[model samples]
Target: SAVISQKPSRDICQRGTSLTIQCQVDSQVTMMFWYRQQPGQSLTLIATANQGSEATYESGFVIDKFPISRPNLTFSTLTVSNMSPEDSSIYLCSVHGQDQETQYFGPGTRLLVL
Candidate 1:
């Protein structure tokens, strides 16, 4: 089983600000996924953080908007840069199941951009 934890459980930020969310996995994983949930929308993959390489972002996100860091197989960080009201969402950390390909999620960090 895999367990992931995230910091700054929730926060409210002003527009144009930035917040860095940290995630730590109890076990090493080849890929750690970052996701976003906006309002009532379903979770969207922001990027895939592979150890020792730059993160692979999803089509809608750019590096400037969401920069991810994967220092090792068990740790990663995601920065929500130059925030705006539209950036207000629940950011989550996830890891692929070791036994199966299914993804397991963290509780998520809730951000409110005003």
Candidate 2:
């Protein structure tokens, strides 16, 4: 099992700015992922953060827009750059559990860009 926590549970940002959301896991995890949940929509994977390596972004998502950092097994940060009203959503951090299949997610950071 893995417990995940995220910072800035909710925030209101201005357009053209950025926000960084932190993720911390209770234990080391092999895989960590960042996702975005738009209003009334399912989660969309932003990227896969790999420790000691550059993060792998998903299709239509770029590193410049959603940069990720995995400093170690249990810590990571995802930055949403150049914010816009369309970017308003709930950003989530998740980690693969000890079972390596099940994933645990942080509460999420809700951002509203105006």
lDDT of each: 0.94, 0.92
Which 10 residues in a row give candidate 2 its minimum summed lDDT?
A: 96-105
lDDT of 1 by residue, 5-46 (tens): 999899999999899999999998999999999999999999
- Estimated TM-score for each candidate: 0.97, 0.97
lDDT of 2 by residue, 21-52 (tens): 99999888777999999999999999999899
Candidate 1 off by > 4 Å: none
Q: Which stretches of candidate 2 lie over 4 Å from their true place?
A: none
- What residue pairs are clashing in model 1? none
* Residue 70 alpha-carbon offset, candidate 1, angstroms: 0.3
